[model samples]
Target: MILNNPSRKEIKNVLDHAKTIAVIGLSPNPSRTSYIVSESMQRAGYRIIPVNPRADTVLGEKSYASLSDIPEKVDIVNVFRRSEFLEGIADEFIKIDCPVFWTQLNVVDENVFNRLADVGYTVIMDRCIKVEHAILK
Candidate 1:
């Protein structure tokens, strides 16, 4: 089954209300695409929680090994991981009960999205959160 993302208005609402984002698979290296997008979003005034096991910190923010390790509430779980790893990430999302689930462009799995939606979580796959933010303006 194919997955359909929310409308632009819904995306805009998520962007407007979400203040803190837990970025899973975020890399410390500036050259990486994850780092670029995450950094751009951070600069746009969103508090970014870097979730990378291999890095102690990224973009001046302390990084956690996983979303389960984040101590505070996170508005969105932005994933930059490959499609094959999404099921595991989805499990973490289920545990955290985050309001929104987003994956970077060209990454998606309909089954994972269906599971998130089953739990009433807003799912956004194959979309760039940073681009959506810019468009909302």
Candidate 2:
């Protein structure tokens, strides 16, 4: 079966209860969309954990090489990677304790979505977390 994004209310609930967000593929460059959006989220009171192998840090938080490298608990696994990378990222995501898997705007993969959704994961795709937070919160 195909997958669909959760309702706005459900998405809002996830954001409402979430605190720490691990941003995969987040760039250290401030001009990058990943960096810009993440910085905004950080300023909005959410803890931003950068998961970029190339960056030492982003938004002043230590950057992990991968999601599994993060030591602390993460409420959301927000991905800024392209569509082709979602499957690989999803593979790593299930191994961690995070509950929500969010893909930035224009990023979506039906196969990845179905696989994660089949296992009862909360998956949000093709939507910007920062945009959702601004509209819902």
Model 1, C-alpha of 40: deviation from truth (Å): 0.8
Clashing pairs in 2: none
Which 10-residue span in candidate 2 carries the lowest summed lDDT?
1-10
Give the alpha-carbon lDDT of every model: 0.92, 0.93
CA error at residue 26 for candidate 2, angstroms = 0.8
43 Cα displacement, candidate 2 (Å): 0.6
lDDT top scorer: 2
Positional deviation of residue 32's Cα in model 1 after best superposition, in angstroms: 0.7
lDDT of 1: 0.92
The estimated TM-scores of all candidates read 0.97, 0.97
Per-residue lDDT of model 2, residues 6-117, tens digit only: 9999999999999999999999988999999999999999999999999898888999999999999999999999899998999999999988999998888999998998
Number of residue pairs clashing in candidate 1, backbone atoms closer than 3 angstroms, sequence gap of 3 or more or interchain: 0
Model 1 / residue 114 / CA error / Å: 0.9
Q: Stretches of candidate 1 above 4 Å error? A: none
lDDT of 2: 0.93
